[model samples]
Target: MASSTITPASLPPAGQTSNFVDPPYIGGKFVAVNCIFLPLAVIALGVRTWTRLFVVRSFRWDDYLMIIALLLSCVLTGVTLEMLNWGLGKHMWDVPLADFMAQFPKLNLIAAIIYCAATGFTKVSVLVFYLRIFPSRNFHIAVWTIVFIAAGYSIASILANIFSCNPIAKSWDLTITTGSCMNRPVFYFANAGLGIFTDFATVAVPIPWLRRLQMPARQKVAVGVILAMGCFVGIVSCIRLGSLYTLLKSTDLTWATTDALMWCTIELNLGIFGGCVTAIRPFVRRYFPRLLGLSSGGGYTSSQSRSRKHGHPLGSIPHSDRVNFTNQDNQYTTTLTTLRGAPDNGSEEHILASHPSGHAKDADGTTGIIRTVEFDVENSSTAPQRE
Candidate 1:
């Protein structure tokens, strides 16, 4: 997507040179895409941060990494916009040779570096978030391996772009014919191919574990939808690869590379947006329960009450609230309380009430007598003791 000067051989015959060049109108498209999508991406990130810090109250490493990714994305957007002013989105012959050589290659190198950093941290953030929920040792190993590969590729891409040409300055200053440069088209294709592969791998990693969770069908589908947003990012990566092909084959560099630049921006920004989607579910479920058709009274059912009455362990019930029991006048009562938010470690605490007689049984032949009541608590750690 970088700009390049037209070689002398590309020029028209001396007598046929025209005074005016037709505009391809690429700058407007670049500006329009940035104006529309960048703010939405930023807003999504903000909502996720608020949910993690204030609602869940359990911010972790993934949140920090996403913040870094968002920051780098902002830089990428700003630099790319600046590039339009430096002869981007114009035919190479339309641009003055001095202006094209002075700004195009240097600015392109900076954009590439930022792109690698942004994408690398974004994938790492996703894997780190996965680590919090999935406890399988083998899954952990697999996620960490992907993280390492992502980091290594990002570093290598940055270094390759920085040192692509001998005497580095020669990459921008074409006057220095004594230096040589790597085959840039081959490098671009390889880097983009690896990126697309990792995108698909990340999308697939969480599916099996999510399916194994012991939750209701409705809940599982909700979780799956959030994780599957990565598939959209993968789709955009494929589109970007095609655009890169067009860019590499094009001799009218600035005019033809607009599609490539636009898709690159979209792919990275959407990565940030998709990473934020899963973290904000608590906020949606809390303030907008009706949006998902969740009942306001915490969705308790009669069977759950009966299970508590018979002294059933809380672990046997899927997605049940924390419960406490009390014994009085030869009778047992159960009190259920909801935790303020889902715990990061997926563990819950329960309190079971027992009689001093040690051999008591209910009239129905149940091993223990119990009754059920329910309430909500702001913090699981501060839940009330049995009275």
Candidate 2:
């Protein structure tokens, strides 16, 4: 429900194409839906905290910043809507207690400023985060450049938010007595252009550089897909810009503003999603345990591994040719069932079945006890040894 005080003011005079715009929209679905997704995003973030703990993790800082920005933006939007709800009750409820907020005036645009700040701040934060994660010199310059441009534009937007209405309250849930905002379309257009371009820079900055990395075709595709995932958010940004126009042009803006808010919220939230997805190597392993294979990177202390093995369901792990056993303290041991680089025949099995005393510790921490599981990459898994 809208405020009674805001009803006549929220609308443009009949037969006129012009309208008095509220800085931030209230009593719309935009605020409601965004409130719901915020928590889920934060929860997704919490579950991924494990990656940060592993000493050999490959996570990045931008991942954390992106998550934080999403949460902050979500909360700020929620708070702004709550404020609108307060206004609605004050102006329309039977015995509302929020008249103080309604009467204080100037709060609409202030709320608008808060929402705008959250919007811009979230975008810029995500941009810097993307820049941080990618590997390129241009990525650095691009992040800083966009930081100055987008952040500076937000300041301009805040100024516009402040001066849009003469008495300020006029900028928010308007009344018939209120003075209308200044050149709303032009203001929106400038800000919209700045915002759209900033999103483009943010979304595009990493593509060229990522394209140049000398990786395997499969790995390059994986990286490309990850970086390109941001384009989905870019689409949302474009839609949000359209919504900005719908919001500016419509007087009865429940639908337009809701649509606009939804798109913008999605754009920002998707960015958060992108950030979190980048860190999903560990998360996917945690949530979908089967797909990731329950292994601790096999660096667990000997004692921890034993306890874990005892606690873990039997056969949950297939029997490897070799098994590692760790005792209390720093002692490590491996029992290998088969030797590597062996002949492709049963003879290889017999060689391991009746092996000689080839006792030796290689630099990679493997000894005669046998390292059954081998990740054949350059950084191969260490063979097991007797303590």
Candidate 3:
């Protein structure tokens, strides 16, 4: 939730002053949140980049959108830090009236815009990543719908914040007395309310699709837990919304906004962290396979082997997993369905075994009568081919 600043029009009339007492300085809490979460976000995105580019060797639109989100997040974090310098977390009485009048509101306006853009891109990136992995047509439709809604919300938020005050400069420049502003509290509340709604909606979209996948119970549970961790972002948004309400109603904005701003940092950072989790599996499988109960080769385990023998495709792998079967003619038929525009053999394991002679070999050195099932919904009832 973006913190809403009280406009000068809400202040006391001429020859009057607020009776509110200055509260204890708690700006350090804001500083601490930024220091911790921003670096965590950077590290998460950095590892995600390495995992996608070097390990998986598949970089797509989702990654690009995440990069944009990160950039905007950094900009927002920087602006927030700059806000602290002008007494952002101090009591209104403590701040120099000029700094409070000019500097803080300017940065606040900028922060609101950047927050909207960053969050919008983050949600869209997660949805796009879903598109890359899940092949269900219905799921794709849901994801695309959410993408449009998120984009629309962000655009509306940016526009509203930009023109919240007619004669835009008046948004930050309290000296311009003639200009009027939209209901600042209502705008921020609606924006944050929609943000929280979308947060839960994005997390909910994958559940039904995941349940339909034919995976072992243990693996299914593990995968679900990983994705469910995204709920933390939604929870943070709720907390931020509460803090936002407190800040908007508060007479002491600079002091009361500390928690709201801190929660905002967490929400954005956790969004980045959540979006990167599934995509970084290849990196973990490569460097820390034991952590995931995977072997050094990053191939199917014994349970997966049993599942494969039954013609059930292991559900954990992404779209990039490729399988090749060599017929007696020594021609290879790749069975794994890859996403359009992705490199063949780009993701995780190359299930194709090479042989010295002109025949396909399994990993166990079986050189003849290779069996591989083609995964296609249309051909679901077809028997596995032995070649």
- Give the clashing pairs for model 3: none
Strongest candidate by lDDT? 3
Ranking by lDDT: 3, 1, 2
Model 3: per-residue Cα lDDT over 158-264, one tens digit each: 99999998798999887899968997766777889999888988889998888777755555666776667688888899888898888778877666766777888
Task: Write down the worst ten-residue block by lDDT for model 3.
Answer: 324-333
Structural similarity to truth (TM-score) of each candidate: 0.76, 0.57, 0.74
Off by over 4 Å in 2: 1-32, 48-50, 53-64, 83-111, 131-135, 167-170, 173-181, 216-222, 253-255, 282-387
Model 1 / residue 333 / CA error / Å:
7.0
Candidate 1 lDDT by residue in tens digits, 134-240:
88998998889888988889889989988999998876676799979997766877888889888888888887887778865666677777767798898899998
Report the CA-based lDDT of candidate 1 relative to the real structure: 0.72
Q: Flag regions of model 1 displaced more than 4 Å.
A: 1-22, 297-387
Candidate 2, 374: how far from true, in Å? 15
Residue 131 of model 2, lDDT score: 61
Q: lDDT for each of the candidates?
A: 0.72, 0.53, 0.73
Q: Which has the better lDDT: candidate 1, or candidate 3?
A: 3
Question: What clash pairs does model 1 have?
Answer: 334-371
